[model samples]
Target: MKINPKFFIGLGLLLIIGYFLQDLVLSDSQYIIGVKKKRQEKDDSFRRVNGSPLSQAQRDTFKNLPYYAPDRAYRLDAQYQGFTLRDTLRMATTGPQPEAYLRWGQATFILNKQEYKLTLYRRAFGTDTTLFIPFADRTNGLATYGGGRYLDAAVPAPDDTEITLDFNHAYNPYCAYNNSFVCPLPPAENRLNVEIPAGEKAFHE
Candidate 1:
C-alpha cells in the first residue's frame, strides 16, 4: 500500500501550525506571569524596606500592602492626544512649594459607558518618557487615599502615540504614609467622577 505524498505534506503543515500556536500561547502566558512577578516584588520591597513610604508602625505589622483584586477592566489602552501648545500646570504638594509640571498630553478613555479624560504631565526637567498621572476618583476618602493615587505611563517607544493606563499599578503617594514626604495633589482636571475600585487602598495610618 502506497501512502499519498500529499497526505504527508498536509500533516507536516498542520504540525508546524500547532507548534507555532503553542509557542504563541506560552509566550503570552509568560508575559502575564512576568507582570505578576514584578508587581509582587515591588510590593515585597515596599513592605520590607526601611525607607519605604509605609510608616514604621505599619511596617512592623505589615505583611502586604492593601490592594484591590487585579482587574483587567481597569487596564485600558488610551488614545493619546497631543497638545499643540504645551502649558505649564501648577500642582499643589503637601509642602509649601508648588511643583511645576508640563502638560504632556491627554489620554481619553471610556469606562462603564462614561467618557473620561486625564491630563498627563511631565516634570519641567524630566527627559524620560514617563508620564505622571495623578488622579482622584470617587473611591477617595473611602477605599483609597484622600490625597489620591498615581499611575505612571511609559511610552513604549519614542514615536509611540498610544499608551497603556494600568490602574492595577496605581499606588498611593508617599505622603499617604508619612507626612514628611511632599506628595503632589491630583490636579482638579485629573479628578474623575467615576469610581475606580482598582489599585492600592487607603492607608490606616
Candidate 2:
C-alpha cells in the first residue's frame, strides 16, 4: 500500500532504536546484514524522503541491469491520451545510487503542481497509493525496456521544494526489474508527452 513519508520516518527511528535493542530485530542473519548496508544509504534516502529498503526482488533486478553511467541522464517527454508532459531527470541521489529512481515505491508526487489530486493511483489498506500505472511507447520497448519505461514517485523529502519533475530519473517498474514482481501499471493520467532518456536503460536480461 501507499505508505507515506511519515511512516518511513517513524519506522526508521524504530529501526535505530531496534538496533540498540538488538534483541528485538535480530531475527536472522539476513536481517542484520540488511540493517548494516541500509545504514550507509541513509543520508540520500532520508534527505530525498525515500526512506525504505529495496525489496529482495528489486535488488535482484539491479544485478541483471547494466552498470550505471554517471554521465548519462534521461529527458522524458509525454504526450499520450491527449496530455503533454516533460521532465529533465536528475539522478536518484538518494539511498541507492540507482541508475534510475529506485526505491521500494512509497513517495508521493504532485503532478504539474496540482493541488487537488496528489497521487495518480490509489494505494491499498486505505493508503490510496500502493498502485502505480506507467506507459511506454514504441522506442522504450524496442530500445529501452521491452515493457517500456518505469517510474514511481513515492518518496520523502526535507520539504516539498526538493521534489520536482525530473525525467532523468524515470525508471522501469519492478516487473521490469524481475518477472516475479507485480508492479503497478501506469494509469492514463501518468502518461507523458515526449521521450524520456534518463534513468535505467533497457533491461539486459
Candidate 3:
C-alpha cells in the first residue's frame, strides 16, 4: 500500500512544529522555575532572625514575600550608551542622608511600543562593576513597593552596546520592609511613567 507523498510531507511538518512547541514550553518552564527559586531564597533571607531586613518582631510573624508572576515580556534588550566622562550623582535616600554614586551610563529600550531611558549608576568608592538601577513606575503604591524597585546589571565592557534589562528580577529595597534601612530613591530621571508589573510586590499588600 503506497501512502500519498503529500501525507508524508504534512506529517513531517507537524512533527517539526511539535518539537519546536515542546522546546518553547520547556524553556518557559525553566525560566519560571528559576525565578521562583530566587524569590524563595529572598523570602528565606527576609525571615532570617539576625540579618533580615525585617525587624525581629516582623521576622517572627513573617511568612513569605509576595511576587508577581514571572513574565518574559519584562525581559528586555536595551541599547547601552556609556558615558565618556562619568559624573558624580548624589542620590537621595529614604533617610536624610544622601549616598554618592557615579552616573555611569544609560539604557534605552522600547516597552509597549514606547521608548524609555533609565540611568545606571555605580558606587562612588572603589572599582564597582555593578550597574545599579533604582526606579519608580506607575505600579508603585498599588501593586509594588511604594518607594520603588531595584535592578542590578553587570557593567558592560566599553565596546558592548547591548544588554538585557530583566524586570522580572526587579526587587523592592530593604526599606520597603523596614524603614530603618535607608535605601536610595530612584532619581527623577529613572522614574518611569509606564507600569512594570513584574517582580516583587508590596510587602504589606
Candidate 4:
C-alpha cells in the first residue's frame, strides 16, 4: 500500500532529526530486537559454516518485518472515541473484535465460529497517554516468520477528542529483520483469523 505524502514527509523529517542527533540515542538494541539480532547472527554464522551462505531470506532476518508487504497493507485511520492521535510506523491494530481479554493486551475472539486471540504490546513514549505500537503476526515463522508488523499510532490523550489508528504504516518488529533484537510476541489477544494483509510480510530469512 502506498503511504500518505504527509506521513512520508513526517517520517523523513523524523529520520533527519534522528540523523542529526545520533548521539542522543543510547547504544542499546530494544530488548526483543536485541535478542532477535543475536539469534539471526547465530543462524547466519551456522549457515556460513555449512557453506550454504545466507540467502536473501536469511539476510532479511536482520530487517524488521512490516505488514505493508507485497500482499497486504493496513491503514491507520480509525477512531473509536475520545482519542486524537496518529498511527505512525509502529502501530499494529487488533483483529476479531468482541474477544475477551485473557490478560492485559492479551485476549481471544471468535472468528467465523472459530476462536483466535492476539498479543498486543506497545513501546510507549512521553509521560502522557501516547504509545508506540510495534507488533508482528503469527505468520512470522510460517508465511512471514510470525514476526508481525509495526503500526505506529498516536494514543488517545487524557480526555482527548480523537485518535488516528492508521494501518498504512504497519511495520515489522525489529526482531523480524535481526535476531539481536528483542521483540514482544503477540499476546494471544492480537491474533486474528483473517490473514491481515495490510502490513509487512514474512522476512525472507
For model 4, the superposed segments whose C-alpha errors exceed 4 Å read 1-73, 76-130, 134-142, 160-162
Candidate 2 is scored at a TM of 0.37
TM-score per candidate, in order? 0.79, 0.37, 0.93, 0.41
Best candidate according to TM-score: 3
What range of 10 consecutive residues in model 3 has the weakest lDDT sum?
A: 45-54
Tell me the whole-model lDDT of each prediction, alpha carbons only: 0.85, 0.41, 0.92, 0.44
Q: Compute the lDDT for candidate 3.
A: 0.92
* Highest-lDDT candidate: 3
> Which has the better TM-score: candidate 1, or candidate 2?
1
Over 4 Å off, model 2: 1-64, 67-119, 126-133, 154-163
Q: For candidate 3, lDDT tens digit of each residue in 1-205?
A: 9999999999999999999999999999999999999989888888877688888888878889888899998999999999999999999999999999999999999999999999999989877668999999999999998889999999999999998899999998988988778899999999999999998899982
> Across residues 83-176, which tens digit of lDDT does each residue of candidate 2 receive?
1232222232112332221122222333344321112222322443432335554456655675555544433322433323334444565565
| Model with the higher lDDT, candidate 1 or 4 | 1
lDDT of 3 at 190: 98
- Report how far residue 189 has shifted in candidate 4, in Å: 1.5
- How do the residues 1-205 of candidate 1 rate in per-residue lDDT, one tens digit apiece? 9999999999999999999999988876775676577678877887876667877677788776678876777889887887778799888998999999988888999899888999999888667568899999999999999989999998445466777899988999988878889999999999999999987898774
Q: Cα miss at 57, model 4 (Å)?
A: 13
> Roughly what TM-score does model 3 have, to 2 decimal places?
0.93
